[model samples]
Target: MAEQLAQLADDRALLGRTSTAERVSDILRSRISEGFFPPGTRLSEDSIGGALGVSRNTLREAFRLLTHERLLVHELNRGVFVRVLTVDDVEDIYRTRTLVECAVVRGLGEPPYALDALAGSVEEGRRGAREGDWKRVGTANIHFHRELVALAGSERTDEVMRSVFAELRLAFHVVDDWRALHEPYLARNHEILQALRAGDRDGAERLLAVYLANSQERLVEVYRRRVGEDG
Candidate 1:
């Protein structure tokens, strides 16, 4: 997780004085969602604290916050590790996305209402594709969904989705082929973006619902296969 620490290092000034733990947790959460710390990887308080220039107490506080979010687990006689998501957990996350993301679209008061955040995320994914960086593509995909939920203009909703994406990354890390999992979605995301740009709000909502449902099914199938092979 050295790379994870470096990212936090780069953004160190964001911590400020107040709510330091929350800021630390945000960086750690981003690392998880970006797949830097994959599922079940042990997170050492000493190492992370040393790297981020934070105290062990602050780092532990961040771990505690993530633990509450279901992104980290504290094991007996062991250190904190990234959570390994269950199939049920995956399904529940998808369910949450349907209600949260699709509702954002359904609640739109006007068509062709697009945020640069969403457009920028799509651009990021395309650039990732050009570089053959499937992990980057996956991260951009999560950002796209986050931008979608942000349309509701709710800080509380964004907070909920952040944890959701971090947990989803657990399943993503186990995929046998990252490109296969992420490449197809690039164009799909573009289509969703274009729908919004073209004032096709209902179309966008329908597409997202189907896209999420199909993704859930594929994740379940892939997860079960991994379980069988491991067994």
Candidate 2:
């Protein structure tokens, strides 16, 4: 009986180790997205590993992956923390997104095959927002923009936009009121969809440009306000 119990314990432990890595990744991602783990919060391998019941090695691997994606930054002596998005970072990301998304719209002589996907993502965003699932709302928002960019007909552009979008997700974390920050944009998204559906690419492009600029300003304001409060 003791041997059987020991075997059961081992099985549970193994299962936990596997599960812990996935759970830890999700937890860290959500916290980063929610601004709970802000820029420059030192990530101690031993502490996080213990907290998540993951091996130090597994945690390090996770850090490395995020670091590669530019979501986390690693310093030689200071350790890893969430990447801080600066003013320049915001400008660059917005510029790239605007350029890419505009090109995507221009490329559309008529609505591309991906219009349905974009519509679906908008609905997903609305549903997530209605359910008060801000995280899902954020995910849907990213997907919607990503699908728009994909219409540019370049795989490489999509890849670059994905990376930028991930960093933007981190920036969105700075907003204090999640629903207030994201809810207002849902209708604007639907409006863009309406224009696109009518094959009004020029109008859609103009609206997208304006929307992205406003979003950047709002995000920057929130970040500055938060930083000032903390200081």
Candidate 3:
């Protein structure tokens, strides 16, 4: 917790003078998505506020915004904590991913689509693998999909999936074997990128559908076992 507080202090520079609840929530959201604050960890209002040099009211409002995004939850008496996803939550997240992502690919207007960002994300994952940093690999994998969604060119879709993917990270944080969960997708993401580069949108969409299905199945299996063990 002390380490996390120190990290918050480091990020305080990002707030500068704006100091809005939205900016505070963005910092907290990024930290949460990065697995710095893992699932079910209580968010200390006083400590976080002090660390970020924000008032208690400002911090609470930031917490309230995160709660709306389903990244944090407020217990009636206990306090706010990072959310722990359920099996059904995992299922629904993948469902939403499949729907939105596949449609984005299918709806692409023509070949030679803007794919540099997507390719970069795939390379990022490969670099993480070379470094034996499976968590970084996992993050790069999410970055690949987020870039894929960005191909749609819709801010609203991007906003919605931003929340969905952040929630997805909460699920990822619980899995013990990061390599097992993330390594296989490195090639699949590259495959999707190749199909897009070749103007094979159909093939790309098919590959992505299979990729997401397999991933969801594997994660839910592990999630059930892990949640059951905890119970």
RMSD of each: 2.6, 6.9, 1.4
TM-score of 2: 0.75
Question: Across residues 1-231, which tens digit of lDDT does each residue of candidate 1 receive?
Answer: 667777667767777766488889988887787677888899988778877778888889999999999999999899899998877888898999899899999898875575789999999999999999998899899899989898988999988887888788878988978898889889889999999998888999999999999899888889878755331
lDDT of 3: 0.95
Worst 10 residues of 3 by lDDT: 222-231
Query: In candidate 3, which residue ranges exceed 4 Å CA deviation?
Result: 229-231
Worst 10 residues of 1 by lDDT: 222-231
Clashing pairs in 2: none
Sorted by lDDT (best first), the order is: 3, 1, 2
RMSD (CA, angstroms), candidate 3:
1.4
- Candidate 1: lDDT over CA atoms? 0.86
lDDT of 2: 0.75
Tens-digit lDDT string for candidate 3 (44-88):
999999999999999999999999999999998899999999999
Model 2 misplaced stretches (Cα beyond 4 Å): 1-38, 46-65, 229-231
Local lDDT at 171 for model 1:
82
Candidate 3's displacement at residue 127, Å, is 0.6
Candidate 1: Cα lDDT at 11: 65
